[model samples]
Target: MSPRSASVNEELRRRSRERLLQATVELVGERGYEATTLADIADRAGAARGLVSYYFPGKRPLVQSAVHRLMHMTLSEALEREPVTTDGRERMARAIDAVLGLTRSHTTLMRMHMAGILQAEGFIQCPEQQRLAFLLEDTVTRYGSEQPEHDYRLLRALLMGAVVALLLPGAPMPLGSLRAELFQRYGLEWELGTPPQDEEPAPR
Candidate 1:
């Protein structure tokens, strides 16, 4: 057989990287960050241990990219879900719910991700993170922001704060309250997005 073409090689590398990211999410979620090792992630991915280091400088960056990929996928799905509309407010609502929902559905993974952000390594600017930022910035633009760059940063900061509040040790805030605050800030109707069944209408 002839040597693989460049496109084929690129595709293979993409798949390999994705497997490592997925494995990091799974193993870290199941075992918590400290207990999960790089070797464990490689084994889980069925790839060689060296590939992890090749794709990421360290476990923190790997985990951050993985979580960013997960967030981007989740936000994309919510925005494109059936009954989809280009309505900016609705899209914004879905975006908020998507990120907030992850806190509940993937608590451990989100917690670890947030913790990693606070570390000295700071935010990892990988492709996955860029993708996530694009989606969020697009959402802000759709929401009629005159300055999407500034608005996007503000929206991100708010979401990050909400996530931290939700995950705060022994002092977590209620999800509905957090969601309500966001919705009110954006003037979103309470009925918008995937609101919890028991969520009350935002105070007028």
Candidate 2:
């Protein structure tokens, strides 16, 4: 058989990395961060254990990238979902809902991710994270921000704060309240995006 071309090799590598990320999300979500090992992730991905180390310096970075990938995918889907519109307010609303929704849907994985961020490693600026940043920046631009980069940073910080608040142990705030604050900040109507079934809480 002929040797694989460079493009084929690159594609293969991409698929391998994605499998590891997907496996990391699944295993960590199921077993929690401490209980899930790199070997377990490799086995779940059907790849060599060494590949995990090759792609990531350690378990923390690997899990961080995996969570970022999940976030990017979730945000992309929400922005491009059926009945899509380029309306900035709508897109911003979708973006907020997308990240906030993850806290509820992937509570364990998200909690672990937040914990990792607080560690010495800080935020991992991996490709998956860059992609997520790009999407958010674009949303900020569409939302008519004069300083998109600055606004993007502010938006990201707010979302992160909201996520942390929702995941706070034994003292979690209500999701509806968080959503309300975000919508008010962005000038989004309560009807935009996928609002929770509960009535919007009155302003504090």
- Number of the top-ranking candidate, with TM-score as the measure: 2
**Candidate lDDT (C-alpha), each:** 0.93, 0.96
Task: List the candidates' TM-scores in order.
Answer: 0.96, 0.97
Q: Tell me each candidate's RMSD, in Å, in order.
A: 1.8, 1.7
In angstroms, the error of model 2 at 3 is 11
Those runs of model 2 whose alpha carbons end farther than 4 Å from true positions after fitting are 1-4
**In model 2, which residue pairs have backbone atoms overlapping below 3 Å?**
none
Across residues 117-193, which tens digit of lDDT does each residue of candidate 2 receive?
Answer: 99899998999999999999999999999999999999999999999999999999999999999999988888999
TM-score of 2: 0.97
